[model samples]
Target: MRQDRAIRTRNLILESMASLFNEVGYDAATIAALVERTGLTRGALYFHFASKEDMARAVLDEAVTREGLSPQAFKLQEWVDLGLLLAHRLPREPILRAAIRLAVDPKARRLFGTRWPDWVALGRELLTEAKESGELLAHAEPAAVSRAFVGAWTGVQLVTEDLEEKLNLSEEIAGLYELLLPSIATPAVLAKLDLAPYRAERLLRKSCGQETPEHE
Candidate 1:
């Protein structure tokens, strides 16, 4: 029972952290804000995390773990769908994007292994699955291409969010397809990995809370 309560508390902490970090960028957020948002005492917070960075790492992991895209023997198209799903999910929410940025920071580079690593891994897994369908370039490196896929999506997100200008989602999606279709998808595979829903989902995710894209 103690262990179960501990797990519950930890989950509560992670959920609280995800919402707080999703709403406010890490630098702008404070323990007071976390406490106020969670209604957890400082001692209770510490009982779960050693520091905010630790909590941020937990949040980053929670984001990936809850994404419903992690490996479970998914097919190539499914892999692509999953990879693009994450790509779409990250940029739409300012807070989640900020946490991703924080995870990649030199000061908090540990998150690279946790969050950044998985994004690319997700891409590679999908690309490899495409290979099984014999739809990818024979000379292509799935892992490298996968990283590029996720990276390109992230780059687009960063630009759009920072500029906060009217975005052309069609143009962005077209540009992304132009880049990846050349290397990662054979004409056959390209035909298979439908980009429309993935592209639409990102816009929908951004419109909703980026942290949770469930209903949207």
Candidate 2:
């Protein structure tokens, strides 16, 4: 029980710090602000994180993995699932939003570095598998395509967030897939792909055993 409580407290601190960092850039998000946001004393906050940099690093660490994705018959489908899950989750998850902000900030990025390499590595791995399984076109290069995809995904999110009309990120990312897949994937595999914006939410629900009815 003590371990569980300690884990919960640590998570609370990280989540609160993430929100603070997202609202205010890394340089502006102070220890006092985090303490106020989490309703915890300085000592309590210090117990979980030695400094603000420490908290920021913790949040960035969580940004590397695809948390809600599952294996699919086509490795390219897994890759799409990963991107869609992030698109669906990033708007609602402060940790992810904060990580992206920190990664793109010149000062913060210099001090802590970004998770772009890690994401690129994961993408390359999946795309390589897809190519080996004949899902990709004969001339497609996994390394190059993966790097480009990461760049495109980041650009889409940043632009969508800045839009005056408040566009849906999931839809934008799905459209990105539609635009890019033809160049990377074979025609048959491309035709089999599900690029719907709502697919991420439905896949996540199905994974959790709370699958929504099709009629809904």
Candidate 3:
């Protein structure tokens, strides 16, 4: 199973690189550090990734891989779940943390671009679906709303990370939705939304084949 071994090696390199980048920004994630952390030879590392920039790009490519938010009857709820899930997992998921760090770092951004557009596109798609399903306010424009929401969500994450206890990110994000949703969502749909911090935990369990009760 050469393919399986190769996949495992690649994943190992990516995980080690993510941890290194999360701890110290992209510039500081030298090959030596990656090799030491992964306990793999420099040749093995180079076989998977030509350089640190290459590894950073690979991490950025998979920035949204862990986003497996289950489908919801309300598309807007899916959008909210996506943000909450990321908020819940970002601190624990080194790959996502590293990707965000690289995206925000001016130096690293020059080498590997940010995934803001991809996230914005995803939001726009969900919001468009929600709007078509009559879940949003009559005047809510999907493109504009999604763009603004993505920007606001990014700001919330940055501010939360700066706090003494960065673990409260999910709460901060839930509060953000509470403040913003009233303006974008219809009264009926608004009442149905779940903005609780624990929402992400439940969503994660549901994703892992656990039975999660549907929220109203």
Colliding pairs, model 2: none
| Candidate 3: count of backbone clashes, pairs at least 3 residues apart or interchain | 0
Model 1 segments beyond 4 Å from truth? 1-28, 63-75, 91-99, 110-114, 168-175, 198-216
Name the candidate, 1 or 2, with the larger TM-score value: 2
- Candidate 2 residues lying further than 4 Å off, grouped into runs, are 210-216
Candidates in order, TM-scores: namely 0.67, 0.93, 0.89
C-alpha-based local distance difference test score of model 1: 0.63
How many collisions per candidate?
A: 0, 0, 0
Kindly list the per-residue Cα lDDT of model 1 for residues 33-116, writing each as its tens digit: 878877889999998899987877766554453253333332555654554555555554434555556665555564435465
Which candidate comes out best when scored by TM-score? 2
Error of 1 at 10 (Å): 5.4
Candidate 3, residue 155: CA error in Å?
Answer: 1.7
CA RMSD (A), model 3: 3.5
Clash number for candidate 1: 0
Global Cα RMSD, each model: 6.3, 3.8, 3.5
